[model samples]
Structures are given as C-alpha cells and as structure tokens.
Target: MSDPATSPERHPDAHLIQQAEVPPLDVDGVQAASVGTGVFAVATVIMAVGYDTLAAAGDGWWLGVGISGFGLGLISLVYTNDRRRRRRRGEKLSA
Candidate 1:
C-alpha cells in the first residue's frame, strides 16, 4: 500500500568527517612562491651569460639586466601567491 524505497538524509561517514573540521585556508602558494624564486635566480644567471655573448655587452651591464629580470619574476610570483591565498580564503576577486 506504500512506497518501498527510503533515502537517508545523511550518511554516517559524512557526518563524522564534517564534525572533525579542517583548517580554513591552505598555504600551498607560500611554498610554491619560494621555490619559484629559486628557479628565477638560476634563469637570470643563464640569461646574463647569453646576453653577454650575443650582444658583446660587458659583465656589469649583463649582470644588471639579469638582476632586473630576477626581481620582476619574483614580484610576479608574490602577486600570484596573493591571488591564490584570496581564492583559498573564499574571498571573491574584485572585478
């Protein structure tokens, strides 16, 4: 006379997992940005050598270019990490 099927509102495992609770935000970006800086350092050295030979520029000038590139790359990395942090924190990015 009645429907034979029934659905459980919530599973036991799911309830337990929810009760445990987790940290709010993840710090993956902080770690990755640090590594990226190291990579950019090496890349700058390589670019310096290349420019020195290709343009016949002096060591000082090439060194300056390499240092500048390295700084730019690092700044970019930091900005990227800030964006990631905002995303993980559930904050909406501004349009």
Candidate 2:
C-alpha cells in the first residue's frame, strides 16, 4: 500500500467526499451551542411576552415562562463561554 503522505487526498472509490476527504471543524461545538442558545433566547422572549395571556388559561404558564427565560439565560452564558474557548482553541491550533 502507498503511504498516505505520498497519495492524493481523495479516495479512489469515493462516490462522494469520503470521511478522509475532510477534517472536522474544530469550532463546531461552539457553533452548535450558539445555535441552541439563539433558539432558547427566542423562546424566552416569546414566553416572557405572552406569559400573562397564556397564564389566564390557568395552565401554570407564568412558572413555565419564567423557567424558560432562566434556562435561556443560562444557556446564553454557556454559549458565550464556548465561543471564547473555541477562539482559544483555534489560536492554539494555528500556533
């Protein structure tokens, strides 16, 4: 077998880009966290704005909305931290 370093990167039998054709995005974790956080933030806003209307139906909506806001805030913090971590990781990798 030929050594990988001497071979062209593409796999000969690949119907599409093979697994070896690409490397993982090192910042994918941060990107995913940011996306999740954004979704949660939107949910928080929806709950906060409509909580009273929802609560009028006697469905414990206030508590649920409050929890949603708190959870979103917490996740936002985590997302921010992950971004910083990703930047640092990138720096390390590049260096």
Among the numbered candidates, top lDDT falls to 1
Give the distance in Å from residue 14's predicted Cα in candidate 2 to where it truly belongs: 12
Tens-digit lDDT string for candidate 2 (9-77):
857665553457677774436565566667666766777677787778875566565576568667766
Q: Cα miss at 55, model 1 (Å)?
A: 10
> In model 2, which runs have C-alpha deviations exceeding 4 angstroms?
1-20, 26-28, 58-95
* Model 1 lDDT tens row, 1-95: 44323335544445333455678454446556666677768867787668757466455565666677679768868787888879888998886
RMSD of 1: 9.9
TM-score of 2: 0.44
In angstroms, give how far residue 63 of model 1 lies from its true place: 1.5
